[model samples]
Target chain A: MGILGVILAVTNLVVVVCMHISFRQYGKYKEHMILGVTLSEEQVKDDEIQCLLEKYRKSFRKYIIIGYITGILVIIPFEWYVSIALILYLVWMFGYIFLIQHIYVKYHKKLYAIKKQKGYTYGKIVNEITIDTKLSYAKDKMPVSPGWFLPSMLVFLIPLSNKGVREFILSNLQMSCVFIGVIVLVKASYLLIYYMFAKQRSQVYSGNSDINIACNRVTKRGYSIVFVVASFFDSISFFMLLWDEIAMGSMTMVGVLLFVVMQCIIVMGMVVGLIQIKKKRESILAEDSQERVVDEDEFWATGFYRNPMDNRLLVPDRQSDMNMTLNMAKPSAWIWTAGIGIGTAVLLLWTSVVMLRLDFVPVTYQVADKFEIIAPSYSKTIEFDEIQWVTLLDEFPDIKASKQNGAATDEYALGRFHIRNEGTCYLYIYHGYSPVLELQLNDMKIYCNSREDGVIQECYQQLQEKLSE
Target chain B: MIFHLNMSSETPIYVQLRNQIVLGIGRGDLLPGEALPTVRQLAEDIGVNNMTVNKAYQILKSEGYIEIDRRHGAKVAKHQKDDKEFEVYLKDKMELAAAEAKAHGIELTQFMDYCREAFGVNEEA
Candidate 1:
């Protein structure tokens, strides 16, 4: 098998292992404690929570085992389609996660019912915990400073370092960096806003806000560290692309591997942070005797937060400290959900369109009143009146340029580019095709080539005739 | 000051924003010449369309509740308590309130008392 195939297999295996660990952790922490009352216990024999946990654990194990086996079997037989198989495995993994979450939510509702029937306490009963609105809404009190996001700007320096680096970045790496940076910034901003505006829940036992503050701090730092690490990784990848020793394909494999590794690290960090927070919360609860229990009737139906009275769209999940759940009762929540769903669909469609264009779309040129060049992802028309001169060259021009809107490959360069001398130009050139046609327009330049030299000569002769007319 | 906009309310968002700003001014929560968040910032904070916020700002500016400038995007305008236009508008609103109260069989004293309470008038004084 090739190195790429091996790398894909290894990454898949790593992902599977990570998934297994995560599922096991979820099973272990299935029982949640609120207000010093552990309503459900997994160790208790024949209890509802334990029974439900066992069922989910068994189902999860069965699916994961089957998925792993199938993945290995497919990869072994159809090694050529390893990439496709890997994607399928990822989809299966996501499906498994969703199935487990559904099961958890279902059983959690049952647990809630049991707690309610047993007259268990949940939130604070006393109204003594007065919120200091000023302190709570203080944006300056955010655990991490905004300056931390500044490091992301360092990515711009990659292009300015050298000419080859600049070319590589503008052609290949700039778009990727922008996409990654935007995602990081969005995530960081959302976290900051959530931390700032989310209603601070009082500790059931005591009015001490220290634990709440500490928990928020931990979560903020944990999330920020992940985003910062991601930005750093993107910068590193850009630098790696500059190295002439590494092939682009191998570099892509390396990037994928790095991404998987980064994900694993983030997961581990979050799990550790959550565990520490849970421990601190428990310790705080043990020290206090006074308990306040509020009716959890709003969350009884689905074990999911659904309160028409609440206006917030994103709320901290009751099931996990590290995750956010949408408040299904609000219209804004629905709007956000729909927006995200549509955005994801659009992204998938755009990716498919790019792929289809690269594989199926042909590069076509026409010569009538104007010279028209059409290529995948980019198309241009050069008017006869704007043409200053038209010449056919036997070799490619030595121009320092940056790609703006089209594809660039070793075999062909078909795109809109910002050439050194010619401000913005359209290029449709095939390396093997001889007699490249260069048109110097009044404002910009146009360079084109074809599979046959005769086609270029005919186009040139046609352009001359049109110009004369 | 934090702007709390009710998305589920029958009132439009721009109207709600305007009413809230007016209420804030009445409550002395927003001071004259105090800068409000830019339209873009407030829109993002409330997760609403920017045009909704812009409309609110526009109404506020036209009514002399706030002023918009090129340098400082938007700010609460200086209080003009004796403006002729405002007096006419208040008289029209009060007439409507009086007619509604009369239709509901509310006495003038009770209606005035309610108005006094809403306006934060000190009865003892």
Candidate 2:
């Protein structure tokens, strides 16, 4: 391939890789943000809340590692042939955003609707000691959906994929960053928008009845901005790439660098948003926790806590996901996030190095060269047509394929694989460049290369062994 | 002691907390002049809003069930010669429960029997 082609190819690979990383990061960010919104301070105190946090954290950690590893394994050789995998991954990315994420969000809304239909939720009982009647606001009703900002942010992933104009820029470190920097100009605009809405909606959500409406509007507006900005970034980045020579000029480079700096600022803005939400959640919960202090006349007069709408706004009396924890007083959460973040960064850096090595090294020099392997027959187009799973089933019930990172060495390609069987079970194996598969029939270890001869020979050998066993 | 709060119950959490404390006092679970839990502690105990326990304590203080001093914490109040309200309160509680039980189609004997079973009473009359 020509130098420009190589650069374009590599840039695309890098951008997609970065986008994937960012996508995962955004997922975690959204997860935490949603949790931030949904979880009250009282809920935080609850063991269930802690469990869910840990659960999300664990899932986030697992997916990050899996994705990174998969990217390394899948992209190294595929970087040469990235156009195909890139297209596939983009399709999958869009599918996940529109299909999976959308469905989950819809389910959440449905559940919330059901709960709202029910007059009151019977919250859990908390503590074995110090039972108090007047202080208990457990029966106070709250809506299942906290508001709109969360859901909007969540579904932005779909539109983001649809607007792929910035894909090139987002992938190209030099140009993509310039696109992000240009968005800094819009921050003032975003703030202005936020200010306008905040002013207009200041008194809108004074009570429980306003929660759904207020939260909905806020989230929708917030999400709309996010999508709009993403679209801008996409197109602007593409345009910058179009005018590369001029864009790469000294003056343009300076602009590009500034844009990069602005992108960093945007990242910082996300961090600020995260912190503000957390602070708001904590303060609201703290205020709710002190609900028992209402005077006697106020208690019976308005029947505030007792009223269904009022109850939803009141603090829960049970051990919910939101509760104040003794541990919360300590700076442990920050320390934990920092520690894990550092560890994750280190892991990514290490994997990136490994992937770079894999990508740069010639295929002949790899461990494949070490094995005195005969070249596979280029013409032996064995399609594996014996009632194979992929073709026989209209939709394979449980066959799932995920990008495997580095689960196995270069000799045996490996990383992360996800398999889901929605219906009937059918066994199917992915045929890849250097296949390292442990078959189950008689438990045989089989290794094969993309070369037709090598694969067939290995298959025959495995079949012979299985027959003997 | 394990404190329970029923958020849905008509009884306010503070009243429940107070009632539990009084029961604890009568059962000799708490001694005279013993420090009861602080407002924060009581709030944490029942998992209800802290203000609920605080409200209960304020009422308890007025009724002389407990005394709150910053240095000493909430202590079981000293006994007084005039326990008139205590008897009236006890009678009122029994009457209300009995009336509710009767409304639920339970005879007085049946209600007493249910209470005995519930409390695992082995005391001879």
- Best by the lDDT measure: 1
RMSD of each: 12.0, 22.8
**Compared with the true structure, what per-residue lDDT tens digits does model 1 show for residues A324-425?**
778888787889889997996687567656745654566777997667877777778778899988898997787755556666544566787665434677
lDDT of 2 at A20: 42
Docking class of 1: incorrect
- Give the worst 10-residue stretch by lDDT in candidate 2 chain B: B39-48
DockQ of 2: 0.09
Task: Report the Cα lDDT for candidate 1.
Answer: 0.60
Question: Cα miss at B78, model 2 (Å)?
Answer: 6.2
Residue A463 accuracy (lDDT) in model 1: 88
Tens-digit lDDT track of model 2 for A365-413: 0122112222211111121222121111112132333222222222323
Candidate 1 wrong stretches, greater than 4 Å: A1-23, A30-38, A42-44, A47-51, A62-303, A309-311, A350-358, A385-402, A408-413, A418-425, A429-461, A464-469, B1-125
